[model samples]
Target: MDVLLTVVVPVYAVEGYLYQCLESIRAGLTAEENAQVEVIAVDDASPDSCGLMLDGYATRHGDLRVVHLTSNVGLGLARNAGLVEARGKYVWFVDSDDWLPSGSIRAVLDKLRETEPDVLLIDHLRVHENGRLQTDASSPMLRGTVTLDRLLAVQHTAWNRIMRRDFLTKHDLRFPAGWYEDVPFSNPVLLAAERVEVLDRVCYHYRVGRFGAITATRSERHFEAFEQWDRLYAWLDATGVDQALRIRLFTLMISHLLVVAGNDSRVHPRRRRQFFRRIAGLYRRHRPEGYQPPVGTPGIKHRLVAINSYAMYSALRTGYRVAGLRRRSTERTPVVSQDLPSAPQRVQTTSLR
Candidate 1:
């Protein structure tokens, strides 16, 4: 039987969550549907027994294919390894720390058969450590007829979308190495696709606060987002996107950078001003001709960046933080929080965006 979908899972130090992640893909699939799906799990030189576990699991499951790498290649290149082995009509990259919701695969397959889209976007829930699930703010935007600009407004996570094999190959949209790799890859995939469709359903359960998860950890390497966005700009120039698209992408780039800057988990408090200054520099460099900032808080942020006023930006962030604290205090509700690294300002940082 011809493969309809290939689910690529890149495994690293996720031994605790690997079984659930693998099982979720096959959970709601029927026998016939199972035959049409292929799963490639890449063991990226994990120090744990994940490679051995994958080998054992592949022996028991005919649909599972395991790729053992000689050395750790990080998340992006590990995914590339799995992609090289993908043979299905469409490829979906599933993170080893996340799992699909029940019947998600079936729903995806149905949509794939119906629309035959070059790219398919799906909604996902943020599964907190406390087991609470929250819908992404961008979920509502996924509905209706989605254009490239609208799709770009949504999150750029690779796991939320499936790409037709030929579309990816034709564009040569391989993941780049290093953090924030999705920044370049996901946006370009949406831009390059001729036919894109939205599933409009919560198909993925993205686990937050997972131990050893990149986003949940604090590190200086978060600066990699800058380099990644630089690559995206290079792609935009190479593709010769229209001015309208450029304006939209520029807005997204600043918003994403602000998120990185504000997230205390990602950026050190002492270096946040430095990061904001860098964001301002990018804003000045990439601001399209005749570009007008959007209205409201985001507009104000864009203006601040344009002027390179890190002090004003910091004040704005502080104002919002104060308002949030007042609002939460009025409610007087106990918070279920993740275990963050011990720092003086650690308690203040929790999903600013």
Candidate 2:
């Protein structure tokens, strides 16, 4: 059967919630729609039973194919492997721990088939561990015209988008191999896409807060976030993108650095000083002239980075912790202790191996 939409799921050590994620897809599609859907589950050598579970599911569902990797290549490579095997008009990515709301598959397929966009953007519901549910913060700006600015302005999530398989292949878009891989991949897709559309509906049910989740834990690998952005910058710059858009990316770069630093509490204090040394130089190199951080604590932190002042940033962070004001955002209640915004979760990938 000619596939209409291919759902690529990268599986890792998510046995705790894998079933719900897959069941949602099963429950979402109708008999007719299911016929045109192809599900590819990439098992990243998960030590857990996730791979075995996927194999069993494939036996039951004729359209679902299970690809088990011999070793763990991280989420980026796993998704890339699936993309290589995908034979569908459109491609959709769903985290192994996250699920589709009932009927989401059908709704997304309808839009993809009708509009036939190079990429389709959809809103998601973020479900926090504390039972807090918030609509994606970018709903207002993600819709309407498909300008480079607006598209770049929205969340850069691989799962929240459905792109034409040809569009991705034609552009050679693939996720980078490690932390913060989504942005480098998503940004290019957004930039290359000729026609993009936003579906106002909330089709994705995203789950946050796991004991070992990426947002919850931070270590040396976090530095890869910058390297990821640098690769993206090179890609965009090669295309001769407008300077204005490059400035926007620079602003985003600063914001992401702060957010990554804020989310990380596991680093040793001395190591952080070393970390800041390397990142501060990057901040100086990447920040556009006359750029200011967005208002609030994150902005203040960004200024510290801009000035290359690790000492000052440390002092303010200590003051906030001592004053018991570190968790507060300038806007609303933060889903996580991280000073980041209400954006989509960047670490929502397979937890295998």
Candidate 3:
């Protein structure tokens, strides 16, 4: 029997969340659907019990297959390994710490059967640390058959969609093995896609873990983000894709980098200026014609701030220092207010020992 979907999970030292994520994947699939679904868990040389847990899962479930690596590789490499090992017709990438909502797999499969699109985009729930929930509803984007350019402009995350295996293989699209890998791969995938379907259903629950997660913590590895952005922009310039699409990709890259710089404290002042200069150069070189910036507060400022390297670096350094001082002052002061909301319920989902 041919498999319909393969769920590829790249596990690192997320031993505490592995079982729950697997269970959520199982629960998301119906009995029949589960039978057709192959769960490929790639252990990226985790120091914790994640590798052992994956071994146990493979032993118990007939559909589960665990691939253990000897050394720790980044997320993109693990995902690429899973892609190579996948035998299903369609592939869905799921983070080891995150899981799909109930019946999400079946819903996505149904949509896939109906549309038979090269790529299917679904909604996702952003689970914040403050117990706030945000949904990436696809209705607005689902008005018509979306072109590659439009899809590139809208969705950036690879986890929220199910992509046909042949399409991926044909174009040789693999995630770049780096810290910010998705940006480069996603642009190419979108450019290669002929027809993409946007399903409004929310299928993914993205857990926000502040301290331990990759996006939250400050690290020097973030400097590589600029390199990936440069590669993506270069790829767009070389490809035969529409000029409008190329411009959109460039703007999106610059805007995203600015936001990352704004939020990060570890990025050095000189490096921030360098990133800004690179983006400014791209903006001038491309000079996207009749390009209207997206509406909203951050949208306009993000573009404007990205245009000037010195201004951005200065503002970023000042903001970082101010935030650091504020945090220190708050720590020194006693708790004076009781009106603040309580922290969200934190669930420890697994046990390594």
The per-model lDDT (C-alpha) reads 0.86, 0.77, 0.73
Tens digits of per-residue lDDT, candidate 3, 195-314, equal 767766667778875457877766767777777777776676677767777667766776776666666554555566665666566566655676766677545554665456467556
Off by over 4 Å in 2: 143-147, 265-270, 289-298, 321-353
Off by over 4 Å in 3: 136-150, 265-275, 281-309, 312-353
Tens digit of lDDT per residue, candidate 2, span 1-353?
67898899999999988888887786845678888888889999999899889888878876579899999999899999999999889999899988877667877777777678898888788877765677666655655444567667677789988989988878888888997889799888877878877777677877876766675665777778778888987897689877777777777777666656655564556677776776778777666655667788877877777778988998998888766764553448545543313223332111101
Q: Pick the candidate with the highest lDDT.
A: 1
Cα lDDT of model 1 by residue, 1-353, tens digit: 89999999999988889999999899967799999999999999999989988988898886699999999999999999999999999999999989887778988898889888888888888888878877688776776555667778889999999999989999999999999999999999888888888877778888988777889778888889888988999999999998999999998899888888999888999999889888988887778887888899989998998998988999999999999999988896787765421111111111100
Q: List the candidates ranked by lDDT, beginning with the highest.
A: 1, 2, 3
What TM-score, over all chains together, does every model reach?
Answer: 0.92, 0.86, 0.81
Count backbone clashes in candidate 3.
Answer: 0
Question: Number of the top candidate by TM-score?
Answer: 1
lDDT of 2 at 146: 45
Return the clash pairs for model 2, or none: 12-352, 13-351, 13-352
Q: Which ranges of candidate 1 are over 4 A from the true structure?
A: 334-353
